[model samples]
Target: MSDEHSPLIPASYDIVWSIVTVLIIALTIVALVTLARSARRLTATQALIWTVVVLFIPFLGPAAWLTIGRGGVPVERT
Candidate 1:
């Protein structure tokens, strides 16, 4: 019967969906937090530009910019 092959649900599907959702949430949190901290150090315009660029560009654009572009050397205040 069709019942034998009916597949509205599957264990693997649920597991994969859960993992994807968790990864998305984690990425969003990391992006927002990194942006927030960077905003404090960067000029208003720079921060805005970077934020938009990071969110819109696909794949490595966001992570690459955040990791290498923003990792500047620290300066001491007088």
Candidate 2:
């Protein structure tokens, strides 16, 4: 028998939510670091564009910059 409103939260749910929350925090930190580092290598206009993208779009923006916008190539060594 269950109570009408016993704050019905399960332990599994709590664990899942905790994991999700941690992942989000970690992703946000990584995104900010990537944005800062990439911004330093870009021109003023490009940096501004990327900044807006990362700020407004969140996850996809940062991933896009790292994967696609960064030219996706390895630099040659002399």
Candidate 3:
């Protein structure tokens, strides 16, 4: 009889990958929501460009927006 091969990915690694995937998705959502809710900080064209960046570039897009992109905007507390 022929021998069977084992699975390529281990169970522990699968869990870790799942967590990473969820985190990336969550970060993207938060970035998009924050961008949408900004009060006149970004113009329509700028917002559209940022939306494309955040959606297409995934990890880096959202990270850049949250860090460098939003740097010049002032925060309002009500």
Q: Which consecutive 10 residues in model 1 have the weakest lDDT in total?
A: 69-78
| Descending-TM-score candidate ranking | 3, 1, 2
| Span of ten consecutive residues with least summed lDDT in model 3 | 1-10
Query: Model 3, 38: alpha-carbon shift in Å?
Result: 1.3
Per-model TM against the reference? 0.56, 0.55, 0.79
Q: Write the per-residue lDDT of candidate 1 for residues 37-75, one digit (tens) a residue.
A: 767677888778777766676435467555764676243
Q: What are the lDDT scores of the predictions, listed in order?
A: 0.66, 0.69, 0.85
Q: Which one wins by TM-score: 2 or 3?
A: 3
As for TM-score, the candidate ahead, 1 or 2, is: 1
Report the lDDT of model 3 for residue 38: 76
Query: After superposing candidate 3, which stretches have Cα over 4 Å from the reference?
Result: 1-5, 76-78
Q: Residue 56 deviation, candidate 2, in Å?
A: 4.3
Write candidate 2's Cα lDDT for 1-78 as tens digits.
Answer: 775443677777888988976875566567667767666567788778877776677567766766777664234455
Which candidate model has the greater TM-score, 1 or 3? 3
In candidate 2, which residue pairs clash? none
Model 2 spans > 4 angstroms off: 1-8, 56-58, 71-78
